[model samples]
Target: MAIDELLDEHEQSERVREWLRRNGSALILGIALGLAAIGGWQWWQRHQANQQSQAAGDYQAAVDAIQANDKSAAGKVQALPEGIFRTLAQLELAKSQVKASQNEAAIGTLRAIRTSDQALTAIVNERLARVLIDAKQADAALKLVATGDSLATLEVRGDAQLALGQREQARDSYNKALLKAEVGTPQRRLLELKLTEAGGTPPKTESQS
Candidate 1:
């Protein structure tokens, strides 16, 4: 090889060595981070599986008890003390009460769900609010879906607030309900109708807030 070409090749090799010297710790750190992330994900998946298994068992027991027409027995499952287990118990109790035509007791069970599983809080509150409305407990339902409550969806919030005569607040919540794309097709159409009923325009079609 020519002397100049040899010198250039040596220079390139030195530069590569220098880069490795400076960034070796960073490279090792990146590998460690990747390994830790994978480990954490696996650990989380296992924990979630265990939780779901336990909750499922409790829910099944409740269902069996209900099928036997034993209302009190349906509520006596060995609960996992948290998560969907507790929510399942409340839901079963509510179902039993509703079956017996005890609207008051059903509302009480659903209301208990509002503070049980926080991740499922929005759904529970919405269902409970509907039960409350059906039972003519609009005032209590309104309290559960106040201006800043985190335990309800926008659509249900709007409906509950409207039932309690909070027109303006209900309008805002309907607008929000229109924004979430997760509510599709017939539900969206219904929400649009509700918005009009509340004297507001649907989202992206008008400037009403």
Candidate 2:
């Protein structure tokens, strides 16, 4: 019992002396690192919250402007003229633009989104291709398809192939889409329609060359 007590006292004394030896520097560095980590986390959390809040507020304001039947006001207040907002809003607004016989303006909106948002660029390009095909701008449409941003969803790829006069390829895309979709699903029905329109049966899908 005495030996153990003495050993414990010696350990406590060594720890005290060691702390005294390194005193200020060790404490400062430990405090500094803890503060740096805490500060960094707080900064990141605040920044993320701000960006999300901004995106949400901007979206709500634009929705309100649209509900008031003011296209010009909505456009003016929207966050982007050529980026994320421009992509979704204009895409949503394109039908209205077309109904107003503003085909050129609708096309312009989609084209602008294609340049600014790489994440959505592929879908925009795919839609742009369809619009161009409808307008008989075949070469331009093909170019957009070639520079796709995302994995070409089967629907988009099928439409692109049909536009390019590649009926076989269109059938293939439709077939893949049908397989990916569940039986009796709406997506499967859509793919079937596309295949029928292409005038070809589904081909056996091997590795994409």
Candidate 3:
């Protein structure tokens, strides 16, 4: 409508264009960085999934080897990355080793499964103590079972104590095992016999009533 008004509007449009030109590179760079971050996160997720899949396959192979009585299962398990699957594979390998009478190798395999899980550690310790007792390393077996709270570990500790001629300690350990074991189980009966052999009276059973 007026020349002055049109001139003012033109100046404002040029100023806006000038501002966009000055900051356009920064805007583009910000968009590029955001896209790169998203892409990197996706890549990491895929990488983790692949790693987990590979670990699972390796663990399953180790399990099959153990079931088939293949001695190389232990080496296959040892090659897996540290995780729950790896721990289980190692346990299977140790079981096979023990069955095959490779006590020294089994001990080493069981010892390497030290995880942060207290329950898992207890299980490993129980197996290791049993092997040590069979190997006639009574002192080592006793030490391994010192913190053990399971019935099996307690019985093994009693056996170790008996081997070392500590009848009183053996009696105490057997009694503890009897308390933890079920009333009528064969394990309870065996613990009772062990207690009697250690010069302690067998605990009263439900059948004694």
User: What is every candidate's alpha-carbon RMSD to the true fold?
Assistant: 10.3, 6.8, 3.6
Evaluation by TM-score, superior candidate among 1 and 2? 2
Q: Which ranges of candidate 2 are over 4 A from the true structure?
A: 1-18, 66-69, 73-86, 114-119, 146-209
Q: What order do candidates take by lDDT, descending?
A: 3, 1, 2
Residue-by-residue lDDT tens digits, candidate 3, 31-54: 999999999999999999999999
Instruction: Please give the TM-score that candidate 2 achieves against the real structure.
Output: 0.59
lDDT of 3 at 2: 100
Candidates, ranked, TM-score: 3, 2, 1
Per-residue lDDT tens digits for candidate 1, residues 1-209, read: 99999999999999999999999899999999999999999999999899788778767777777668774553454343555666777777777778788888777677656344455676666677777888877787776666443324677778877887878888988877677633446877788888888888776543333
Q: Per-residue lDDT of 1-209 in model 2, one digit per residue for the tens?
A: 69999999999999998887878688888899999999999999999888767776676666556556675643643454444655566566654555666667667766655444565666677766767766767667766665432334566767777887988877777776666766665666667677899996644334322
**Model 1 pairs in collision:** none
User: Model 3: runs farther than 4 Å from truth?
Assistant: 1-27
Per candidate, the number of residue pairs that clash is: 0, 0, 0
Model-by-model lDDT, in order? 0.73, 0.67, 0.88
